[model samples]
Target: MRVLMVSWEYPPVIVGGLGRHVHHLAIDLAGMGHEVTVITRRPSGTDSLTHPTTDERSDGVRVIAVAEDPHEFRFGTDMMSWTLAMGHSFVRAGLRVLAGDQETAWVPDVVHAHDWLVAHPAITLAEFFDVPLVATIHATEAGRHSGWVSGSTNRQVHSVEWWLANEADALITCSESMRDEVNRLFGPEEIQVIHNGIDVDTWPFAPRPQTAGPAELLFAGRLEYEKGVQDLLAALPRVRRTHPGTTLTIAGTGTQLDWLMETARKHKVTRSVRFVGALDHNALVAAMQRCAAIVLPSRYEPFGIVALEAAATGIPLVVSTAGGLGEAVDDGMSGFTFQPADVAGIATAIRKTLDDPAAAAVRARRARDRLTEDFSWREVAERTEGVYLAAKRRVRHAYGRPTIIERPLPERDPGK
Candidate 1:
C-alpha cells in the first residue's frame, strides 16, 4: 500500500510524542513493504532558499520536508495564523510532491494525517487525489484544556479539530481513553484505538545503581500545565522529607518551564528540583538509566509514550491514573499509580519506591516484561496497516467512486 502521511512535527522539530509516533509508524510501515511518504516541515532557522524543500529517504521512508512560506510569521506570537499558513504551505507542498517529476504523480492509496495541525492539507490533498483520509486525533484542544474550550485560540483550534474529524473517512485515537473522548465530543461513526508504541531495543534495560547519595526522580514530557509538572514540583517538598537527599530532574521543554521553576522556588524545593531542559534521545535514555525512577505525573495524557519508554528502559515508574496512562502502566503490578494532581498521592508513591529500592526494581522488571506483548513497534505497524485497509474499504463501499470533475481553467497570460 502506498500511504501519504501528513504531520506538523518530525525529528529535530519534535514538540512532543506526535512527531515520534509519525516517525516510527512511517518507518515500520515502509519496512513492511508499504511505500510511505511523509510531508512535514523543515526544522527552524532554515527556509526554502537554504533548506529547499528536501525529498529524501530516511530509514525506508520518503520524507519531504517543506520549508515554511516567507511571511511575517512568528509561531509563539501568531499561533493560529501560523497554523493556517503552515496548513496552506503543507497543501502546496503535498500537491507539488504528489504531482511527481515529468508529469508522473506518485499518488498514494490513502492519505493519513496526524493531529489537527496538518488537518487542512490532509483534507485538501485527500479530496484532490480522490482518496480516503485517515486522521489520528493525537489529542484534542478540549482534552488539553480539561474539557473547557476557553478563549478564542482554544475555540478556534477545537473548531478545526471538529471539522477534521468529520471530514476524515476513518478516525483513529492513540488510546482507548482518547477514543471515548472523541466519541463523546464529535460523535464520530467509528474510532479505532491504537496505543502508541516504542522500540524496546532502543531503550535497553539498564538499571540505575541502587546505592545512591540522593534519590533521583525524573519527570519527562512537556512542561505544560496539563502535564502536571507543577503538581510534581508541589510534591517534591514532601518527597524531600522522606528522603532528605532526594533530588528531582526534569527532562523536556515547554511553555511552563519558567512557571515550573518558580513553582519549585515557591515550594522551597528549588535546591532539590533541577530542570535539565530538553535532552536528545541518547541523552534521554542515559538520563533514564542514571535516575532512581521515572515519574510521569500527567493530568490529561491521551496515551503516555514516555511511560512505555520508561517501561522499555526498565525504570520504576510512578504515573498517575490519568487518561490512557492507567493502561500503559498497571498499578502495583508493573509500577505504582496515583490519581492526577494529587500532590500527597504523588509524594507517597515516590516515597514508596525510595523506601524499598529492591521492590521497585522488581516492579520495573515486570514493566519491561510487559512491553513485548503490549508496546512493540512491529505490532503497532501491523495494526495500523489493518486500519489503512479498512479506511480504503470504507471509501470504496460507503462513498463508492469519488466523482471526478475537471473544471476548465482560463489561462492568465498577458502575451495571449
Candidate 2:
C-alpha cells in the first residue's frame, strides 16, 4: 500500500513524542515494503521556499518538507496562520505527486494524518483526491488542559480536532484509553487502538550495582504542569523519609523548570532533586541504567512512551493511573500505578520499589518481558498497516471508481 503521512513535527524539528512516533511509523512502514511518503513542516532557518522539498531516505521512505511562513509567531493567530500555510503546501505537494512531476512519484492510496496540526491539509488533500483519510489523534486539547478548553486558542484547536475526527474515514489512537476518550468526546463512528511502540534494542539493559550509593529515581520528559513534575517534587520528601539516601533526577526542560525548582525549595528537598535539563539517547540510557526506578507522574498522558522505554531498559517503573499510563503498566505485576496528582501515593509507590529490591527486580523483569513480547515497532507497524488496509477497503466500497477533481490549491494567508 502507498501511504501519505501528514504531520507538523518530524526529525530535526521535533517538539515532543509525536514527531518521534511519526518518524518510526513511516520508516517501519516503508521497511515493510509499503510505499510511505511523509509530508511535514520544514525546520526554520533552513532554505525556506514557497514550495516543498523532497528527500529520500535509505529506508525507502520519501519525506517532503513543506516550507512554512518565515514570520515570527507571537500570538495564536500567527500559529494558526503557520498551520494553514503548511496545509496549503501539503495540498500543493499532493497535487504535484498526483500529476507525476517526478519519476518516482505515485498517488497515495491512503492519507494518514498525525494529530491536529496537519488536519486541515490532510482533510483537504483526501477530499481532493477522493481517497481515504486515516487520522491518528496522539493527544487531545481537552485532555491536555484537564478536561477544559479554557481559552479561545484551546477551543479552536479542540474544534479542529473534532472536525478531523469527523472527516477522517478511520480514526486511530495510541492506546485503548485514548480510543475511549475519542469516542466520548468526538463520537467517531469507529476508532482503533494501536499501542505506541519502542525499539527495545535501542536501550541497553544493565542492572544497577548491588551496592549503589543512593536509590536514584529518574523522570525523563517535559517538566510541565500536566506532567506532574511538581507533584513528584512534593512526593520526594516523603520518599526520603523512608529512604533518606534516595535522590531524584529530572531529565527534561519546559516552562515549569523554575517553578519546579521553587517547589523543591518549598518542600526542602532541593538538595535531593537534581534538574538535569535534557539528555540525548545515549546519556538518557546511562541515566536510566544508573537509576533504580523510573517515575512518570503525569496528570494526563495519552500514551506514556517513557514508561515503555524504562521498562525496555529493565528499570522498575511507576506511573500515574491517568489516561494511557495505567494501561501501559499492570499495577503490581509489571509496575506500580498511583493516582494522578497524589503525592503520597507517588511517594509510596517509589518507596515500595526502593524498599524491596527483589520485588522491584521481579516487576522490572516482567515489564521487560512484556516490552519484548508486545510493544515493538515492528508489531506497531503491522497493526497500523491493518488499519490502513481496513480504511482502503471502506473507501473502495463507498466510492467505487471515484474520480479525482483537479482543483486550484487554496491560497494561504501568512498574516492571518
Winning candidate number (lDDT): 1
Distance (Å) between predicted and true CA of 203, model 2?
Answer: 1.2
lDDT of model 1, residue 77: 80
How far off is residue 21 in model 1, in Å? 0.6
Clashes of 1: 0
Candidate 2 error regions (>4 Å): 45-52, 74-77, 97-105, 392-416
Output the lDDT of residue 339, model 1: 96
lDDT (Cα, 0-100) at 181 in candidate 1 = 93
Question: Residue by residue across 57-121, what tens digits does model 1's lDDT show?
Answer: 89999888899888777788888888888889888888777775766689889999998888888
Off by over 4 Å in 1: 101-103, 393-416
- What is the overall TM-score of model 1 with all chains considered together? 0.92
